[model samples]
Every structure is written in structure tokens, then in C-alpha cells.
Target: MSLPTVRTVADLRAQVAAWRGQGLRVALVPTMGALHDGHLTLVRRGRALADKVVASVFVNPTQFGPSEDFARYPRDEGGDAAKLASAGCDLLFAPDVSVMYPDGFATSIDVGPVTRRWEGAFRPGHFNGVATVVTKLLLQGLPDVALFGEKDYQQLQTIRRLVRDLDIPVSIEGVPTVREADGLALSSRNAYLTAEQRAVAASLNRVLRDVVERVRAEPGTVADAVAAGERALLAAGFDAVDYLAVVDVASLEPLERLDGPARVVCTARLGKTRLLDNFPV
Candidate 1:
């Protein structure tokens, strides 16, 4: 069965308002809509946490760079709505670009420092687009809780910061990064990889896991572990290694030594696809 979809803010709010009027809690799972197992996991989680689940499927042009894959990003509303229905999602808000950003739309939200490194550094103005669109989604749906996959760890953190700083009045929940049996983190962009490239992709997570293990076994070797991890990725057939660092999990600042909680975060390019994965240290 196809899930009910709404395109305009008016219809979205009216439906949500009806649910809220009955004292039902709503949860929003925002996605770019190439619907996969990882995305379905989020929808299931939203259903578990609230009386109704809303999954938004907007490609969010603002988040894509001029040279990025915005034009070619996979989109299938009919297929996605079917998948959402199977996952127990109550509504699908698949808005058109014009509906999301009207003629006079001219504001952007910057979450600052949390978005300064890694994905942000590589794809400039990316987080500004993310923060803005997310803020809009949270406000438009006015969900009691918003669920995001930790697969985009930095993006998750950026959203949390924006909600707290802006006082958005919604609980932000981070779901764990869902991965394949071999450990490759699930991503919409994974569709870009060839069979050979797909096989090589799982090594990215293995390298990060090894780095985290090394850090735990020898806290002083954080820098050494990071450098070694980068070399391992290149040797494992990755075209380039963007960064591999031990960062304070909360603040995302590079850590010289492991004093408190930390994470090993990395981004590497395999052919044309960039793979991101992080492990707790």
C-alpha cells in the first residue's frame, strides 16, 4: 500500500494538528529519499517512539554543492512511499523544491564550529544548507521528536546544536549507524559504487575499528593511530584519504590524548564516491 503524502506546509500541519489534537505524539524521520534498509530502520524507530511517524523525502538542493550530485541524486517517491508504508511510517512529506524554497526564500542557518571540519571542510556551505532545511522540517512538522541516523555523525551533531541553540522545542534522537554484514556503512551514495569499489568500501570501517582498538590499547598513540589509519585506507585501494582523526565525540575537536570520551572519525574517497565512518574509542 502507498503511504499518504503531503506536499505543502498547510496540509502537513493540518494532518499533524489532527494527530496532536487527539494527544498523539509525532516523530519525524527526514531523508533525501532513495529509501534503503537503513532509512527503514529509522522509520521503525520513529514508529516505536511516537503514535505517528512522518518521513520527509526532499533531496534538499541547498545541502548539495554546485559541483556535487544534486542533479543526479536518486529520487523515487512512488517506491519510497511504498517502502515507508511497509516500515509503518504514517505520512510521507515529499515536497517539491519550489514548495520547500519559494520565490522569496532567503535565509540560511549556520551551526558554527560543530560543522567546521571533515564533511564541512571538504564540502563548504554543506552544513549551512543542512541546518537551514532541518530547522524548517522540525518547525514545519512540529514533531515531538526528530530521529536521525548517526551514519552522518557530524550532521546529527549539527542538528542537535541548532535545536538547542535555537530552542526548537523538539527532542533530537540519534540512531546508531546501520552497516552491511561486512561493515560498510549504509548510505544513499553507495549506489554510485561499482562492484569492485563496493568490495573495497568495507575496508574503511575495518581501518577505523583498528584505529579505535589501537587508541584504547595505547592512549598516547592517538596521533600515530590516525596517521596509520589514513595510510591503511590508501593502501586498501581508496583513491584518497580526506582525514582520520581522534576527536572529542561531543565537541568534535581534535584530541591530542584520550582524556574523556572520543571517537575515530574518517572520510575516504573510493573512485568518485566518498565514504564516511566513525567508531567509538
Candidate 2:
């Protein structure tokens, strides 16, 4: 397991191209540092599927809103390096801000339509940054498959659409949402919560599950069920509500009825931490 540092795009491309030329399949696990079991799970899955794994632990500032905690988003390069190395990652592309975004950079990969709802609507330019950075990473890493966690449900779908519509040559694989014992969806933002806030945060995940169960067992319209779930979470001491949507998993369009498979998604603030979670119905 080698932990070679690649500071520029060309440097990384050369290394990846050399390995790929030798008939080795490469995999890329992109992340925003603060490596946890959730992130490690993605790397492990990549290793299982590829001969050489490249994990890019970059925290892109362009993704964060002005008021958002771009400065405070957790990052630990040494720790991340060790984690990736032990997880059998061959290369770690942890570049600096200037390295990834030099001066006079005007390009953006905005996947419209599907990117205009849910998380995208709430966080403007967030998905644009995601799409742009991901396109660059895919072009730079050129892995056969890129594994993404299902916790960012809308995001996973967006990536799939972007890859398909744009004719990117990489495959998109989704990992299921990792959860806490009490069923809190694992998130990097979870580290921002206070002890009490964390307890109250469990309401979001529970509400989604409740919506699915209630919809299936009790049978109701989407609005009726979404309202019920919202009330329960609001009563549980959440600070502010974002949205609670039941959507088609394939297209991410809001659903009117729970006739078949759907995703119950929610996002809200428990103090400063913005938590997002979804469950399949």
C-alpha cells in the first residue's frame, strides 16, 4: 500500500495512466477528508472491485456557500493518508486549493433539471460544484467505477444522470446509507452537533422511516404522510425544517402517491448541523 502524494492534475493522470496501461483496473473514492467508517467502507468496496484504488480527499471550497462552514469543514491529511493506506488505497490525490483551481477558472458542470430540486434548490451552486469537481476527478482519475454513498440520495442520482447524459465513460455505483445504532444516517456534518442536538437529530431519520411504514401499512397520499412526519419531527425539538419529500428514485421527481418504490427524504437543522437522510419505500 503506497501513499504517493499527487499535487497536480497532470501528475495524477500520469500515475493513473501508467497503472491503467498495465492492464490494472483503477477505482476512485472521492471524499472531503475527515475519514470515518462510512468513508472507509467506500474505500473497502473500491478495493474489492479494482486492482488499484485511488482515494481523493479534497475539500472543495466552491461547494460551500458563503455562510456555510467551508473554513471549518474538518480536514486531516496525515490521518486521511494513514486511513487510506491501511484500507489498501494505492494513491491519495490530496491537492491544495490552488492546485485544483488555478487562476482564471471559469468552467462549471451544471446538470440542470434534476439538479434544480431538493438539495440543489436549498443549496444553490452546491451541486454545480459537485458536478464540476466530480467531472474533473473522473477525467483525472479515470476509474472504471466511482462509488458514492446513498446518504446523499439526491446527489447520488444527480451523479448518475450527469454521467449518463454527458456520456462520461465511468460507471456509478451507490453504497447504502450507513446508520448509527439508533438509525441516524452517518454524515460528515454530524460532527458539528452538540450531544443534545445529536439526540434531537435522530427525529429526521425516524420520521422518514415512519412515513414509509405509515404509507405502506396505513395507505395515504404523499402530502398527508409528509405533513404527519413533519409534525412529529418539529415536535421533537428540531431547530428549522428544510423539506420532507417522497420522490421517484430513478428521476428524483416528487411523487404524489406511494404506489411502489420511492425515497422518503428530509433535511433540517439541529442547532448548526444540517442533517439529510432518506429511506427506500
Using lDDT as the measure, which candidate wins?
A: 1
lDDT of 1 by residue, 213-278 (tens): 998989999989888998899899999998889998878999988889998888999877889998
Lowest-lDDT window of 10 residues in candidate 1? 271-280
Superposed on all Cα atoms, the candidates' RMSDs to the truth, in angstroms, are 0.7, 1.4
* Candidate 1: clashing pairs of residues: none
List candidate 2 stretches off by more than 4 Å: none
How displaced is residue 79 in candidate 2, in Å?
Answer: 1.2
